[model samples]
Target: MEYQESFINYLRYEKRTSPHTVVAYKKDLDQFVCFITEMVGEFDVNKVDSKLVRTWIVSLMEKQLSPRSVNRKVSTVKAFFRFLMKEKIVETNPAVNLPLPKVRKKLPGFVEEESLHHLLDDGFFPGDFRGVRDKLIVALLYATGIRLAELMQLKGSSFDTKNYLIKVLGKRQKERIIPYPREMNNLLFEYLEIRNREIGYFPDILLVTEKGKPVYEKLIYRVVKKSLEYVTSFEQKSPHVIRHSYATHLLNKGADLNAVKELLGHSSLAATQIYTHTTFEKLHDIYKQAHPRG
Candidate 1:
């Protein structure tokens, strides 16, 4: 337990991991510790071996967890053991050489451009403050490719209106700037006018409730879901779907991959490449429809 606490501190302070990630790691480690204690009458990190790790993996699978989720748990264990090895608390890494289950990558779902255009262009939003705020939320998410947390933390000062770029604080507190369209600038100016009248500028956050408080996750999700339902029949309609649509649309329009990666505040090109699968699917359809051989 002492070693586990040290490892968590290392992740939190030294690694600068996000709070959400630290909580997940701690949860996974606690579960592993509990499993080991139940099996051996007491938890002992040194007693852990590959066989014991395999037993726990089997137990997790029997609980009907998805392979992807199980794999993540196993990775957490591996990271902990690696930390233990580095600290000289354990000489052998029991989590090492554990085979992970293969996970199928599902292409991210996105709203079609025409559907989004229909929703935005056809006056689906109302003229009220709530309507304008909700509409701009959807537009900003799709336009900037910023994550929900980033949007939540957004401040009014983050916008460089004359430069037409907004600054985003991404995972691990990394900051990046993304430029928006000229028309989006106009929408933002209008939203600000409504925001000033409704909320009275007390919060100073870029996005606020009509009551002058910062927006919470559930409210954001509800806003995005309700707005998306009018035009998209996609099974999943969350803020992330809007973000996925943002990346996919950019790639479909011939935006460079690296440029999109930077714009989306991704740490690696690999993380940003997932959207290319959707773009390729579009190209395949167009080829089939336009080729003379068909």
Candidate 2:
């Protein structure tokens, strides 16, 4: 228990892991400790063996957990034991020999370009501050393809309107600049005007609540979901869906893979390469419909 807490703190303060990642690692570790305690009547890190770890994997599979979820949990166990090994508290790493299940790769979901066009150009958003702010939220996510956390962490000065770029602090605190349309810059300026009038003063943060406080994750999720429902019928209407649309659309329009990778703040080209699959699918569809080989 002490070790788990210390590991979590290490992830939080030292590794600078995201809050969502830290929470997931904590949950996985807690479940593993519970499994060990129930089987051996005590949770001793040194007492853990490959057999015990295998049994826990079996239990997770029996519960019908997806292979990907099971694999992530296994990764948590491996990371934990690695820490113990480094601290000289464990003689052998039981999780080292533990096997993981293979996970299926699913294509990312995205809204169609026409649907997004209608949503933004049509009379979907309101004329009030909330409407302006909500529309701007959707615009920024789709236009720049930044992650939700990066948008939430945006500051008033994050935008360089003259240069047509917005600086984003992405994962691991790595910073990158993404260009935006001149139209989006004007929209943002209008939103800030309304925000200033409503709050009676400018807040240091961007994308704040109606009351002028910094926006949280859930609120942004709701804003994106609700705004998207106005134009599309997709089941997944999260901010990430908009991000996927941004990437897929860029690739569909013949944007360079490496250039799209930079806009999305992906650490590697491999991560951005997934959009190519969707782009190829679209091209195949067009070929099937337009080709007259028959």
Candidate 3:
């Protein structure tokens, strides 16, 4: 229990993990602790064996956690055991040989291009203060294929409109420069100028509301949903779908897999491979039309 408190403190202070992440980790750890308490009334975690760990996992399976969720719990337990080992509390890690729960790979749902175009076009109320900003938010996310968190971090100082590039901070604080079309660069520049001059917004963010505050998650979602409502009839619509649309369109137009991987800020090529599935589906359609296989 003392060690758990220390580990949690380390997470909050030393690691600087977010409240949400720390809470999730604690909840996962507590579930294991509760199971151990109920099983034997008062057993030391250091004395736990692989057999006990396996049984606990079997109990978790009966509770119907999804494979992915169970796998995450397994990962949390492994980390906890590793921490104990580092502190010399245990002779061996008991969860070492525990079988990882298998997870299915399902493709993320993304909006089609026609729907995306209609959605973006609907946000083009040029005269209103927030309308223009919201439209650019949607456009820039699609144009650059940046993550929501990365997009939220952008400042007025980051854009290089003259060179048609936007410098972005990607995963693990790594910075990368992404190029955009001339039209996008122009749109961003125009929005920036208006943002600083007419709206009197702090010239720090490329996108902001009327209050000069950096846009957050709800704002981003609202912008995406509002634009989507105007353009397409798809029940599923969000800023991430715009990103998916960008990646999908790139592949449909024959962009290299490696290049798309970097543009999307993915840590691995495997993460970017989902777009290839979209391209393969499109290729099959073209083949069916061009070839007389039917």
Candidate 4:
């Protein structure tokens, strides 16, 4: 447990991982520790071996965990062992060179552009403070393709109003500037006016509740879900769907893939390539419809 705590601190303080990621790492480590203690009658980092890690993976598979989930657990174990090796608490890494389960790729889900247009432009959102804020939430997500975490961390200072650009702090504390549509400026100004006039107090943070308190994760989810319910019937109507919609819409309109990757703040183009699959599917449908042979 001491070694685990030290590694967790290393992730939090030195690596500066997000709180959500740190919590996930801690849970994965705890599960691994429990498995080790049960299998060997004791928990000693030095005594762990590749065979034991394989056995743990087998046990996770037996529990009917999905391949992607099992792979994530394997990655967690591998990372933990690497951390131990770096700290000199363990002389060897136990989980190195371990094989992960194969996962079938699923194309990201996205709402159609027409549906989003109806949602945003068809009087779906009311004309009040909360309504305008909710509209902005959906608009900014589609316009800028920012993640939920990035949206939550946005402040007034993060915006370059003159340039129609927003600075987003993405994964690993990397920052990128994304340009929003010019139409979003009106919604932003209106939300600010109502927020200040009604709440009567302004914080550094941009989005706040009716009570002027900082919004939370669940609240953001609820806001997105509730508003999307009026427009999309897709089972997954979370903020990420809006992000996917943003990327898909951009690609369908012939936006450059590399430009999209940079706008999304992706570490590699591969992470941004999934949206191309969605675009390809759209082209396939068009080809099927317009082909002379058909």
lDDT of each: 0.89, 0.90, 0.80, 0.90
Q: What TM-score would every model get versus the actual structure?
A: 0.94, 0.95, 0.82, 0.97
Q: Give candidate 4 misplaced runs (Cα > 4 Å).
A: none
Q: Kindly give the stretch of ten consecutive residues in candidate 3 with the minimal lDDT sum.
A: 119-128
Runs in model 2 deviating more than 4 A are none
Best by TM-score: 4
Q: How close is candidate 2 to the true structure, as a TM-score?
A: 0.95
Per-residue lDDT of 288 in model 4: 88
Q: Per-residue alpha-carbon lDDT of model 3 for 1-294, expressed as tens digits?
A: 887787778677866655656888899988888898889886696678999889989898899989988888877788778877877888788888778678997666667777667656554556566767877888888888888877888877787768888899875567899998788766676787777787675656667777776778898898888777776677777878888889998888889999999899887999999888878878998898999783
Clashing pairs in 1: none
Clashing pairs in 2: none
Model 4: lowest-lDDT 10 consecutive positions: 195-204
TM-score of 1: 0.94
Q: Candidate 1 — which residues are off by over 4 angstroms? A: none
- Model 4 reaches what TM-score against the true structure? 0.97
Q: Kindly report which residue pairs in candidate 3 clash with one another.
A: 118-231, 156-204
| Candidate achieving higher lDDT, 1 or 2 | 2
